[model samples]
Target: MARRSDDAEQLLLPYPTTRRQRLEHLAHRAGGIARRVLRFVLRWLARILLPLLCAAALLQAFPYQATVQGVPFEVQGSLFTRPGLTADTTLGSWEFPDVSGVPFGVHVRPEDVDVLELTRLAGRDLPGFVEELRVDFAAEVPRIAWWLVAELVVGLAVGLAIAIALEMAVRHLRGRPRREHEVRQRLLQFGAAALVTLVVAAYGVLSYNENWVRESRLTGTLAAAQLFPGQLSSYYTEQSKAFDVLGSVVGIQAALQADIDDERTPDTAVRIMTISDMHLAATYPLVAQYAANYDVDLIVNAGDESAFGTSAEFTPEYRQAIADLAATTPMVWVAGNHDSPATVAIMRGIPGVTVLGTKTAVEDGFAVGAGVVEAFGLTIAGLPDPRVYGGPGAYGADAPDVVDPLQRAAVREALGMDDDEDGATDGGAADGENGGDGGAADGGAEGDPAGVDLFVLHEPAAADEVRELLPGQVRQTVSGHTHRQNASDELQDDDAAIELVEGTTGAGGLDNIVRGTERPPIAFSIESVSADCQFTRIVRFSIESAGPAADLGTDPATPQAYGDDVTVSTVYFRPQDVAEGRRCDTDLGVGAERPWADAG
Candidate 1:
C-alpha cells in the first residue's frame, strides 16, 4: 500500500527534477487542465440548453382552444415577438383580423373557423357584430391569461424534469455519487432549471412590454406600469375604444341618412353623391346607405377603393361588400394613385360600375371597353388618375403624352365632340377597349359642339390637361386625393371649370383603426345638376368622433349615443353667385345661408 501511494504521488507531482522530465510533465498537466475545462463547459451548456429546448418544444406543441362570438377557435401561440394575430382563410392569411395586442403571435387556422356562422353574424350589422366580438373576446380573456401562466409553469416543470433526468443519468454513468457530491449535483441541476425558467420569464416580460403594450392606445397610461394586471386592462380599454370608433361610423351613417331623407329634391334637379379614398370596404356601407336614402341619380367615386391595391385586398369580404353596394345604384369610378390595374379590373367586373381611362383586362373576368360613359341626361367624361398601376404587379403612371391623345379621342368619339367645330370630331368610335360611343352629346343632335357636363377624374392636377382638351365644355371637375372636402373655382377659367373634391369616406381604412382616437372623419359631397346640364349646387357632409360614444346604457332606442355633430354646408351656383365669385363654400356671403342651412 505504501509503495502504491508513493507511485501515485510521483505520477501526480507538479514537476520533475530533470529538465526534460519537468518540461514533459508541465505540458501534460496543461493538456489535462484544458480537457477538464472543455468537459466542464460542454456539460454546463448541455444542462442549460437541453432544458430550454425541451420546454420550448412542449409549449409550442400545445393547442389552446378559445371560443369567440359563439365560434370555436383553436389558436396556436408561438413565441415570436412580431405582435401579430394571423387568421388563416381559404383565400389567404388575414393579419390582425380583430385585434392584435399580444406580444407573441396567435394563429387561428382555417380548419378551426366556422366561416358561415362568422359571416352570418358580421353580415347582419357591422356595429352589432363588432360589439359582440369585443364582448366575447373580453369573456375569453381569462382563458388566454391562464394559458400565459401555464406556459411559464409548463416551461419551468419541463426544465426541471430535464435537469433532474440529466443529473441522474450522469450519476449512473459515472458510478455512485458521494453524499456531499450528490447534494452539490442536485443543487447544480436545480440551479440550471431555475436559471432557464428565469431567462424565459424575463424574455417574455420584456417582449410583452416592448412590442405589445407600447403599440397600444393606452401607451401613455401604462408605460410606467408592469406587464401584469395593467396589460389586461389595457387590452379591454383598446377593444372598447375600437368598438366605439366603429359605432361612431354607424352614427355618422345614420346622421347622413337623416339629412338625405329630409332633403326635398327639385323636379328638374338630378342629384349625385361624390365620395373618394375609400381605402378599404369599411365605407361601402356608408355609400350604399347614401344611395339608398337619397334618390342619387349616380355616384361618382374619385377612387382609391383598396388599401395597397394588391390582389390580397380583394378578399371575398371586400368583393361581396362592393358588390352589394353596386347593386344599390350606378357608380362611375376613376382609379386613384393607390389603385392597381387589378383594382380597376375588379371594379370593371362588377356590373353598374364604369371605370374610366382604362381598358378591362382578362383579369377583370368580363368583356372589355368601359372608359367613356354618359349618365343622368349629361355628357360625362372621366379619366383615371395618371399614377394608377398599368398592369398587374407593374406600377407607375402612364405617360401623359401617351394617354392624353387616347383619352381625348375617346371623349370626342363618345360625345361627337367637334374640337375645331369644323363638323368633325377627333376620331370615330373607339375600338373595343375605350368603350363604344355612348351616342352623341345632348346638343350634338342640333349641330352644336358636343360638350361634356362633368369631367370626373381622380386627381385635380390631372384635370388640367383633360380640361384643356374640352375647353369651355366641362361644367365641373370632381376629384378626391387630399382627404379634405373642397369645392373650388380654382380650375374655373376660360377653358377650365369649377372642381369639387371629396374627403376620404373610409376614415383611412384599417390602418387608422388602431391610431388611438385621431382617425379621420367620414365625408362626402352631394352635387346637383339641372336638366340643362348646368352645375347647380354642392352640399358637403362631414363628421368625426369627438370621443368614444357616450355610454347611454344598453338601451337600443338611444340615438344620443353619438357625441359628435355632423357638419353640413351647401354651396349653390347661380348666375348672380358666380358673377360675384361666390362659387365656393368658403366664399358664401351672409345672405347665402337663406336656402338649405336654416331649413331645420
Candidate 2:
C-alpha cells in the first residue's frame, strides 16, 4: 500500500512522464523557436530596411536628367524661387543649374529659356512647351512626395496582413490552441517588423526604376503647346488674323473701295462710313481695318457698343481697340438704349472720340442732341436715341414718351426756325436762306444757306419728324437702331427725305457662335457727299455668308443661315434727286430706280 501511494505522487509530479505531458512539452519548445525567429526578423528590419527607406526618399527629392522630345533636359528646383530650364541663348548668359540662375530678366544671371528658344533647339515648334515647363517645375516636389507617402502606407498595410496570416498558420500546424493574450502579443511584434521590411523593399524597387521617374517628369513637356502671350500686341495680331479670314470668307475684302466718278479733294468729298449696334462682337478689328483701307474721313457709330453696358463689358482691351480706330479717323458716338451712364463716361474719356450725350442740347426736347462737328466743310448734328431718356437713372423715368410736341420743338430749334409774330411757328423758308439762329453756314451752302448738312440719330422712326422740322436744306439723314438694312423702307409716304439705316455692324450680338444655313450679313456704307450736302452719293457694301448661326443645329430660329457670306456688290444712291420729284436709283441713273421701289 505504501509503494502504490508513492508511485501515484510521482506520476502527478511536473515531468513529461505521460503522453499528454509530452505533447505539451513539444508545443512549448516550438513556441520558443518561433520567438527566436521573430526576434531575428525584427533586428534585421531595424538594421537594414529602415536606413534603405530613408535613402530612397532622399533620392526621389533630387533633380535628374529627363528626355523631352528626344532631347536631353535637366529638371530641377521648386516653384517660385527657382523655376525654368537651362538652355542656350545668344541674347543672355548661362550658368549653374540653380534658383539664382532663373530668368527674371536680371543682368547678373543667365538668360531665361522660352518657347521660341526651345523650338529653335529642337528644330520644331513646341506650342505649349513654356507653359508645360512652368507647371512641371511648380508641381514636381509635391507630386513626388505624395506618391512616396502613398506607397509607404500601402506597403505597411500589406506587410502587417501577411505577417498576421503567417503567424495564424504556424499556430494551426503546431496544434496549439492560442491564448488570446499570447496571440495578440506575438502578432504585434511580428507585424511591426514585417511592415518595416516591406516599406523598405517598395521604396528601393521604385528608386531602381529611375528611368520611369524621369519619363514621368517629362510627360507634359513633349506635347503640342497651347499657351500664348496675353500682351495687347499679341491680342491684336491673333484677332486680326481671325477677322481677316472671316472677312475674306464673307466677301468684305471686295467691298472696301468705292467706284465713284467724282474727283473732289479729300476736303471737298467727305467720305463717311456708318456702323452701329456693334454689341461687343469680335468684328471691331475688321471694321477698323475697312475704315482705314477705304480712307474714311468720318466714322459714325449709333450705339450699342456693349450688350449689357456693364463696366466689365468695357475692358481695357476693348478700349484700346477703340482707341486704335479713333487714332486713324474721326469717330462720332451716339448713345443707344443699351449704353449706361458709365458707357457714356468711357466714350467721353477717349481722345479724339466725340460723345454726343444729353448735355449737347441745341433745344429743350433736343437736350441729348449734339451741337455740330464741322468736318469736310459740312455741319453734322448728332441726336442720342430717345430711349436713353427712359431707363433706370438717365431721364429719371421709365418708358417716357419722346415722339411728341417736345421733340417737335427740339427739331425746330435744331433747324434754326423761329416762332412768328402770332406765336405760330414759321415755315423756316427765310431761315433756310439767312442761316438764322445759332446754325453755322460754313458748308458749300455758305451764303445761299440752309440748316445742318447731315443729321445723325439713333432710331430710324424719328427720321420723318426731323426732316419735317428741317428747312428743306438738310440733304441726308443717317440712323441705326433698327438692326436690319431695309428699315428705311417702312417710313411714311410723306417722309421723302433720304434716310440711311446702318445695319448692325458687330453681328447684332451674334457672338462667336453663328447658327443656321442662312448667314447674317453686315453692311458697311461709304457715303461720298459734297461739302454743300448736295449731290450726295452712298455706296453700300454687304458682308454675307459669314457662318452658321448660334443655334443652327439646336434651335430653328435661323434656318437657311448663310453666316455672313453673300455676293459682294455696291449700290449707289443720290439723295438730292431722291428728295426731289425723282425716285431713288441704285445706279444713280435718271430713269432706272431701285428694284425695291419698283416692286411697290
Q: What is the C-alpha RMSD of each candidate to the true structure, in Å?
A: 21.0, 26.8
Off by over 4 Å in 1: 1-266, 359-370, 389-425, 428-450, 487-496, 510-518, 545-563, 575-600
lDDT string, candidate 1, 248-286, tens digits: 333322332233322333333567888888887345654
Q: What would you estimate as the lDDT of candidate 1?
A: 0.53
For model 2 the TM-score comes to: 0.42
Model 2 lDDT tens row, 481-592: 5566753223213323467777777656642232232324666576665533443445454555344334444221121232312222233333342112211111221111
On lDDT, the leading prediction is 1
Model 1: lDDT of residue 310: 84
Clashing pairs in 1: none
Error of 2 at 216 (Å): 66
True-structure lDDT of candidate 2 = 0.47
Clash totals for all candidate models: 0, 30
Candidate 2 clash figure, as a count: 30
